[model samples]
Target: MFPSSRLRRQRKAISFPAGWQIIPIAGKYWTSGAADGLGGWRWTGNLEANFDDFTKWGVGQPDSDMVKQRVALNFQSLAAVFWESEDDTMSMRYICEVEDSGTPTSPQPTVTTTTPTTTTPTTTPPPVNECNARKALFIVLESSSHVGSANFQLGKQFAADLSRAFTGLSTSKLGFLTYALIYHVRVHLHNSDSPEEIVSDILSAAYEGHSTRNTAEGMLAAKLQLETYSSGNPMHMVVLTNGVSASPSTTKHIADLANLVGIRTYAIGVSMPDSADQELLNIAGQYSDRVFKTDWARLDTILGSVVNKVCNS
Candidate 1:
């Protein structure tokens, strides 16, 4: 059994396949299967094989579903899992290829922007000094049909919790955006009045669902609304999705826009399979310095951690 005291720490450090190498929806140690179940492939090498053999040498049976099917094996103590298959004489050759993790050591830092337009200095803006400068935190809840109820509920809970926590801070503003069949980015309030109002707004947003899930359109709308409502205040985005974009180019363009606007994005994957838009999520998170994964049970904790990271940073 895993150590009880260290479970949380271990979970935070758990390593998974990510990066450009896994881009275009492919990985070196990837597995491919078909409906016929006759033609399949597992890619790995001697180094990975040896590591897997050594790690699983005396461990009776791995507890993971992927490991039980022999689709993955822990190659090292560094939380790296090697992809492989169980059948040896099925005429399915497991190819080996060199690969890297591709994830950055730390989250990407926030970027600043420069505009070409210039204006003559009149008053110099008084140095913009304010110890209690408020920041606007906009959460776009995609009630699109593409997103499941479980994801929507989790997003609502996260937004409520964040609003509550920030309400206590003197220099924080919390806002809510809910997208329905059409993109509707609603700002519950400009600046928070109380935690109860914030919670109510989140619940009301969840009650409304959009026709389809168009994250790109929703993100663009949210950016525009934030620009109009918050003005000079900083804005951060937290997007939750299970599947990949129907349009890859659109997703890339939105990611670029977020990066350009200094909007920190935290992408949350809820009940999404490893094969579903993992690369896009990683890229989005890489650009915004906030990518995470969790199911319903642990989503609240994940949101709490994310808020702390972004607010403190």
Candidate 2:
């Protein structure tokens, strides 16, 4: 059967020759979304080399609206570019350069040489430790009608102990925010400054009573002071309340603030029971690594422990 017709199946595949190379579209800023549509374009080895070259190109001038986007090697030496396919892909291109020999009277010889150097990426370290690091301590003193001067003295002593423990650590700063019936917050610069002066200033501030303790306002003030003074340094707050507030919502607000700002709240109950709702303490401990409970007898020890943990950590 040399049949009327013969049928043969053929498959065609596109491939590049041995020395043939892919030349990525030049200067076509492709966006990330459109990079996928680019077909048959392959990225060769050592992409960083291309990145270095692009970064050296620098940025363009702004428009009439004074708005401009710049391209440069960041601190990490990472490069960013938009591709032509409107695709933003981390890619670069290659160009083959040819040298021409002009009007050779005699026979001209061509020399080809290739030297590959091993490139080790350079890394930058973080900023050096500064002498101005500050730690904040929010002391909330809440005393009931039955509370005596001795209990207030105990609060002052606890604050003093805390100050002493943290003072030795860094040449930084310390800030005090006291909230009871009213708000009392102050920033203390401890760099070459005396702790006694700071304590005296704290003690001299007038005390205001609102007939109801605003623990929430106290915590908010703490957070605000931490943001204003500490500059994101670690904060430790000690709340000395003998009784629960007449306004329960304020306590809840305090808890929410502590949760939000990651401030450690250590609650000191003078004669109050531990079974009482310690939302502030719980929230503080959740943000920080330590939580403490103390009565009149073990007050100093508890304060010391909290200070040590905060400063050392």
Best by TM-score: 1
Q: Write the per-residue lDDT of candidate 1 for residues 1-313, one digit (tens) a residue.
A: 1223333545455464465232222332222211111122211111111121122222543222221223433243334434444321133333332233444254458999955532222222112112233566667665756665655666676666666555555556666776543244444335546666666656556334434455564565555445555656677766666556544455556666665777766677765677865544643645434777776666666755766655754
Give all TM-scores, in the order shown: 0.51, 0.48
- Count clashing residue pairs per candidate: 4, 15
As a whole number from 0 to 100, the lDDT of residue 34 in candidate 1 is 10
Supply the global lDDT for candidate 2: 0.44
